[model samples]
Target: MKQARISTGTQDLPMRWWSDAKTPGAMIGGIVSNAFAAIGSNRQRSILTMLGIGIGVAAFIAIVTLSQGATDSFTSKLGFLAQTITVSRARNATNTSLTLSDRDVKILSQLQHVVAVSPTISDEAEVVFGKKHWSTTLSGVSFSYLQMQNVSIGSGAWWSSEEEQSRRHVVVLGTKVVENIFGQTGIDPIGQTVRIGAQLYHVIGVIEPDSLLGNDGIYVPYTAVYTPSKPNQIAQISIQVDGTDNLDTVQTEIQMRLGQLHHIATDGSGGFDVTEAIGQLKQTQQQLGMLSGFMSSIAVISLIVGGIGIMNIMLVSVTERTREIGLRSALGAPPSAIAVQFLLEALALSIISGGLGLGLGLLMGYGLSSLLNVSFIVNTSSFLIAFGVSTAIGVGFGLYPALRASRLDPIIALRSF
Candidate 1:
């Protein structure tokens, strides 16, 4: 009797293949089918690995986005606080001492492109309101100071030049000072008398809380505390230049005028220090850019690590599926087809993780902005770069493992399992 023969049709086998001249759709379908098959074989592991990539990418995006937003908000607040030229006495200068006098401010006011000049004098002192006492910065400034600093009186009016000339003691309190001294009680602190270092000052206004500068301050009229005969009178002078003119020329002219008034060297380095508010704004912006870049680098590191994790998992996948690869090779599936299938799977994982990460990152950024009372500024460039990098990482790291799978000897790979 002849030995019984068992036959299984090629179609009944676990793996299948198509002809070489197959249509484009069929080729693509085969790639997709293989990727889904791989994922389905180890659904939990694949999902867990992709989750790791998603988390890393999300963290990177959140940190960079938040940092950029915070930097922008901080710079904006600072810009608002200092909107014009700020001339202060430089603590150090070669030759004569750099001091800005009230006379210098008067001269600057008469110059072309000079909008307004405001002088300030400040000292730290204890303020007493009724039985309450608080430590505060006592600032004496001219009427134009409020306009120059863009400060607004939230409740009452600011002190006038007449009040300053008459030496009438009136004070403007910062929001925190008002809150700390008066609490939430319905009693109006305005029109109330407050004593500062043995002098009596009536509360004229309350300024809203400044976002950049911390609170606990009071503003008094410049003339209320100045003595013309006293040499060391004013602390600093703020000058507003014509917004229409060339700022460089205006700054140069202002410096030259200050040099002439103070009798110092005029080679751009005068006795008094002149700080252009616009220059400060630019510097702040540059610093913010650097900070954003640094934070973005940290995010990139996390993404790279996540990509490496994907590569390692893919290598393990190729090893585990060697028998399947060998079976497919035996069925006339080309090595390039095998490689494309694995590469497509890797790309799919990376693209999906990147998208999820970006969404989560944006959500986290908005959440942080809400919590911190700042704005959410999503950088489109950053999002695109992140997604591109993730995809590149997938292709770059996935290639070796995929090629290794495709190059496996069918006979050996089949027998090894």
Candidate 2:
């Protein structure tokens, strides 16, 4: 009797059970193995559930990334427009050609946020230097026009205020203009005399290739174009503002003031069109935001459908596995373990699908960005948000079915099987 008791001791049984139960890794592994085997039994249903989740998550990521890419492209291209406001001629009832006068320029220069008002005239004409002559587009503008266009003189200097005020015959030539006239000259064109139309002007400065005219630019004093009948006439007026923050206010003020100045009513026939690049950028951003928001709704709907599908499949799985569950329960498996097994199956499907969707989404986003010729923007937040949401969907939808499985009476389940 003593030998039999030693050979069949409960001590070894207790130690084996305790080790398996207390070790979280071993316990979790077992649960995972059971869940995986159950999922493997219904390969088609599991694949369908994963596919649904993948599509939803992929759409969410793709839309956000694509919208950001488009918005970034517009803003980057029009970066300089943020600080500039362009005023152009618009014919009213009285005049066939509307123009801004010297007084208009003076008034705008005094407005808040207005850095400088550059009055300009553009014409195509021939320029002669000594024995050489070249045809180029001539721009008559104030000295401040250089500052407005962010132009810098590569050689010599711009017109002094005194020279501009005195209506002096001075000109600034672009690098290309110089090359066209001087043809790789050994000497700089500064201080040289150039003939524009019937007038002879001195070249006071030369701009590097960085000026608004690029390689083919030429500038003259605004006053040089003034005549007895049109002493202060300008074809275009460019208002350089401080920044883009208050562009609408600045534009409104300019419009109201100009409207009053020109005696045109506000209801119709305003004599000028005030346009800014930053305004277009803002509009683009707003439109892109709306588009992404609309697409996101569709993505969310897909996710909800995917979540519902998971719930339905889990319920079916619980019903089909009644016999196995009953056998496990009769063999001493706890209700908590039964519930966790089903929950793990659902979570595993959601997370794996989410990862697959993330890869597909990134690839889809970059492909669209390339096709649209925009920058590709990677949003890490979208990935985290997608995975997090998918996990929640799994847990929330899987809970009901898990509870049903855990609550089944072993005797009833066994009898059903």
Per-residue lDDT tens digits for candidate 1, residues 1-417, read 332211222112234324432687877775776576666667777787777668767877887778777877776666543447777766676655445566777888887777778888878978887777889888888887777776667888898878877888999888888887787555698999988898898998988765232467888887777777665568778778767344567778878887777777773363677777777777877887787778777777777777787788889888877777777787788899889888877887888888898889888888988898876888888688768877987798789888988999999877855
The whole-model lDDT of each prediction reads 0.75, 0.79
TM, every model: 0.88, 0.62
**lDDT (10s digit) by residue, model 2, range 1-417:** 121111111111111221255677777776886677667767888999999899999988888889888888766655666788877776544565456787787898899998877878888878898777888888888878877766668998999779988999999898888988887566679989989999999998888764545778688888888553663257778888888787788888888888888777652245787888667767877888998899999998998899999999999888877876676677677899889988998988888888898889889999999998888998778878999989998998999999999999999878864
**Regions more than 4 Å wrong, model 2:** 1-20, 86-238, 245-280
- Model 1 regions lying over 4 Å from their true place: 1-22, 80-83, 94-98, 210-213, 229-231, 266-270
Among all windows of 10 consecutive residues in model 1, the one with the lowest summed lDDT is: 4-13
Candidate number of the best TM-score: 1
TM-score of 2: 0.62
